[model samples]
Target chain A: MPPSGIRRRPGGRSARVRATVLAAVDALLAEVGDEGLTLDAVAERSGVHRTTLYRRWGSVPMLLVDLLDAGTEDDWRAPDTGSLEGDLVAINREVHAALTAEPSVTAAVVAASFRSPEAGEALRRFWEDRYERCAAVVHRAVERGEVPPGTDPRRLLVAATGPLYHQRILLGGPLTREEADAHARAARAAAASGLL
Target chain B: MPPSGIRRRPGGRSARVRATVLAAVDALLAEVGDEGLTLDAVAERSGVHRTTLYRRWGSVPMLLVDLLDAGTEDDWRAPDTGSLEGDLVAINREVHAALTAEPSVTAAVVAASFRSPEAGEALRRFWEDRYERCAAVVHRAVERGEVPPGTDPRRLLVAATGPLYHQRILLGGPLTREEADAHARAARAAAASGLL
Candidate 1:
């Protein structure tokens, strides 16, 4: 038996529980969508106690908010490849990959965004955090004289990823790697022209 | 009861029923989202018989599909002001208006797109039809020597509208009229630079 009475390392068990619960959230979202998800279902699926889940997450919307916050934290580091185009391509490709790889989860989160104010707040924070994190790519590009000064990084990033999102979510179309590359290229061109 | 027993004019009552059913769909979608909407609920709200709804729409997804088709048909006429920039701006503004004015319905339809293949097909058809209908703006621009020959109309339109959709749907951000104008200007700039 693993030291049943011993004090656990600070945050170790808590982190593990968070990971397990979030993973269950992901699984449930992927399998049944946000509409069918519930705290009890999450508890049963994660094998975490219902009381703990209730105390921690409180509600389905809050759980989804936490899940989005957790999900975006891992994969959104800015890439620096010595060129603006390179950095942008890297960012666009990562976005396309994430959106495509787990479309169901993306859909679930997006649906939740419309249905729940908490989820919307979480999503907004996620995008804002992501934008702030990646703003360095544009700063680097400006220093390298690859683009003019005052080129807005957030606007450029939005231009780069907007088409892909539109195609995937609104148009219900496929977002190919080639399309991602083209979007990045177009954004770069627009930036080079000082449009961004 | 003036002419109750007489043969009704072709598509008169049928059109009214469709309009009523679709309006009920919109209301339900706005009130409870797609997850909570059902044909029986729509029947109760629409005052159309459930069996009639089943016979006509067959399912909620089909009803949503029809609703989308009908909605787009009325709102998506191509605006031609004899200038590419003007037309594009008009298109962008209309899109922004529609997406913003009824975000809940938009979100519900988008959510349905992810959950149901039938809805996806309907949405795809809706977009394709809209694109086809709006291709004239770019064509007219080319004819007027405003844009380069062979500018892909669909590509230009996508670039024009993608950021708006991205902001409204994915980022859950507000799309201002100024932003819509800016998007149109940027798309025009990109097109002028042979980037589109």
Candidate 2:
């Protein structure tokens, strides 16, 4: 039923099937909310069989988590912008671009993560990894005497992302490219002064 | 029908009824969640009839907004601690106490706020009002030569609250009294350095 010669393997085509189902689930979530997303709809959209979808993910939350797993956080490796200010501006721009690209999807994922513990755990890992990556960049800056060593890398990572999300949800701002750059400049100044 | 003598009039008695309904919604949201809450449950729990609940609030989100309205940010009057450091520390403690006292409620409200415009508007009003109030304190400090006049009040407010929420959600910290004091110190230092 799904695009020709794709028979189920006896050994368990589980990995491939999971990816397909997750893609479908992402599509469904983007179109319909958590309340409207159903296993049948996902199967229909993803081209995966209903049995396959159910066999892999037992519930909506579980399916959502799988989709979340498929998408990772943006790479946090520090930019070599030659200055702390330039590095922060690059990071902030990336964040605003990501959120703006998928506003509704981002909002739903955020809401889902808050409501489900499984989603939260996965989301936490994603954030931790991102922060660690970003922290490495800040570390280099400290070594170069750009910032004080006592700077909390974790707080800096938060400062980079916090304003974007805060303004997106709270202020209904455009989250435009220009604003992201401004945030980066501000955060870099804040951090360099050892204030953050 | 609601507890025998509880009148359901719109002006005086209805105000009491509104309060009772809001309390019920708060408890329900904290216990069950947004999806699980219903008019029937509110009626049964609040002892108000179904017809009355429907007549007052048109939908679940609307009801949630009303509950949020009842809990509006009223503690915005800035305190004069004669210095930025003292003022920030005192304000941080107040915020920490509020969030820690009702983490679940705050989480639910935040999640719902992300999805609903009404909730988002309510949240914006709440945070903006608080920020403006806190900014007034910073302004007073600048007036007294405690901090530089060029300091951005908006940025200062975000940095102050950022860590409190970060610890609560990401690090899972206690957001205790001592920690609030620490936050105040860091935020004030940042403010003084013109980073905030």
Best by lDDT: 1
Q: Which candidate tops DockQ?
A: 1
Candidate number 2, chain A TM-score? 0.80
Q: Model 2, range B1-196, lDDT digits (tens) per residue?
A: 3544454443667778888999898888778766667899999889989888888897777787887666563344767778878777778777677667653676667667755779877766666666777788878888987778887776666656655666665434456676556556665665665554
* Ten-residue region with minimum lDDT total, candidate 2 chain B: B1-10
After superposition, which runs of candidate 1 have C-alpha atoms over 4 Å from their true positions? A1-6, A23-55, A58-63, A72-76, A102-104, A112-117, B1-10, B20-63, B72-76, B102-108, B111-120, B142-150
Clashing pairs in 1: none
In candidate 1, what are the lDDT values of residues A1-196, reduced to their tens digit? 1554235653677788899999999999888888779988999999999899999889898998998789577865799888989998898888788678653777678768766779988988887888888899989988988878978787788878888778776786777887787778778877877877
TM-score of each candidate's B chain against the true B chain: 0.86, 0.78
**What CAPRI grade goes to candidate 1?**
acceptable
**Which candidate leads the pack in TM-score?**
1
Provide the TM-score of the second chain in candidate 2.
0.78
lDDT of 2 at B102: 50
Candidate 1 lDDT, B10-68, residue by residue in tens: 46778888999999999998888788899889999999999999998899999998987
Candidate 1 reaches a DockQ of 0.41
